[model samples]
Target: MIIKTLVHIPLYNKATTIVRTLNSVFDQNYKDFDILIINDGSTDESLELVKNINHHRIIIHSQENKGVSATRNNAILFARENNYKRIAFLDGDDFWCSNHLSTLCALFDKFPEAHIAATNYQLKRSRKTIDTVLSNFESTEDQLLKSFFHHNYLNSIFTCSTLMIKPEIVDKTGLFNESLTHFEDIDWFVRIGMKSKIAFSFRVTAVIDEIADNRSDQVEMKYRKLPDFTDYEAEAKNHLGLEKYIDLNRFAIALAYRMENDIRNTTLYQQKINLKNLSLKQQQLLKMSSLQLKSLKRTQKVLGNLGLHLRAGD
Candidate 1:
């Protein structure tokens, strides 16, 4: 069958949650799509379980461990080489509601000029059992692009699992950066916003499965050495609100290092941000010493356990 929408999934040691994730795709209300699963050097039984599925609409491939950047870039190349018109992403540990694909298709139909369509998703944080979507804007093209960089990742408006893009976007925005440790999607989002019209829908149609035995969350932010968004300085200046977006990113990373007591790296990113771009609360915390920030973070963690959730990303 000619696949119009290629549902690309990348997997690595996701055996515990893989079946649930795949079933979410197989059960989509939108039917004109094909499944492409790339197993990236799993030490677990993820490969065997997938092989047992033996579904005709599903195509499976395996390779030695490469980071998510390589896996996603491979997915992009696969979509283009196979002549697929639209490509959607679903991480091996994430899931979709029945209407996830349908909603994306409808978004495209509603906005014919859109090269990208994204739906909001509920984040399932592991311990707190919190389920929420942090959407602060409407569906306008400008808002869709701005929603992503307007806040920190805790309040991010886009996830690969909720996005469907035309294959042509690859030519304009380029592949996902392999050098990025965790924010590869953020880097790609800026490029896509610069080159394409991003259409968005407020309806929630996906769940980010952090509650599962997720391997991706194993790494620490301090060890990863995230970028402070200086690379996009030129782009930030050209686009309205982009400078504040970059500043917020810098603040988030700097705060991460601050929480870890990595004073040198914290100062490195702190100097890169403009204090005016941050919220009053964030600005106040920025002035706190590393010890103060660590204590406050600990208090927040305790409160989270008690279900006294703060407004996310505030």
Candidate 2:
């Protein structure tokens, strides 16, 4: 499987870490790839810093201050035009272990039919560390539709930087949604994951530098996973117009409301039926909302007495 991959690094005000990030890519154990650096309207000397690296294989694309989604969209166009089979990404603030590419290559070799591969990485703060694990998945469209009922499997994987996907999948997934300011990855992943299997790399070959101000880190808190349901629920309801998706959205909103102690929103979301107008399952779902609401309150009271404060619903 001697295919070429394009590693797109989108840079903005990452002057402090851009060099290290690029160095890590050059240090990759597997070298059959081209590095494309998109200097997205950086006012700092980030571009100058990148030029000092002196790598011939690196191609630089400069644009005035486009957002990440746009930068990535351009990179995809470049990869497609150049005929790259695989596309891997590294944010300017993150760096990968030497074996990052080799590990993904090996996985793709093993699963010829797989369209995407992702690896587990260390989620790091200034000095502390949090470990997360993601596994490779092979799912059909039907299984994916069902999984959405329980949870969004792809989001647990975290960060687009960890994913290595085929170009065709990117094209099919329609690149990152330009309008979203956050959870863009989740939106794109759920769409693509519905069509292809996602595989995880068992090795921890990347370091996701979760700086204090980093968007995800700033929004972090203990017992925070529950609030995440709101974003997906909204995205599903508004962006994806499938009826099955509406059912799943109700279930998720119900969970988020339960977490935030909002019984009313919880019940309201739970009561919607999917009809000609709504489905029978949806009608049944509305009926059970009250029960779920009561149980949620009971659990919250126990937790509150035990000294846990619920953050307002996200």
- Which candidate's lDDT is highest? 1
lDDT to native, each model: 0.73, 0.62
Which residue runs of candidate 1 sit more than 4 Å off their true CA positions?
127-154, 297-314
Candidate 1 residue-wise lDDT, 77-196, digit = tens: 999999998999988888999999999988888887888998877767755434543434543342345434543323555778889999888888898887776667767877776777
RMSD of each: 4.2, 9.0
Q: Name the 10 consecutive residues with the lowest summed lDDT in model 1.
A: 305-314
Question: What is residue 236's positional error in candidate 2, in angstroms?
Answer: 8.4
State, as a TM-score between 0 and 1, how close model 2 is to the true structure.
Answer: 0.66
Clashes of 2: 9
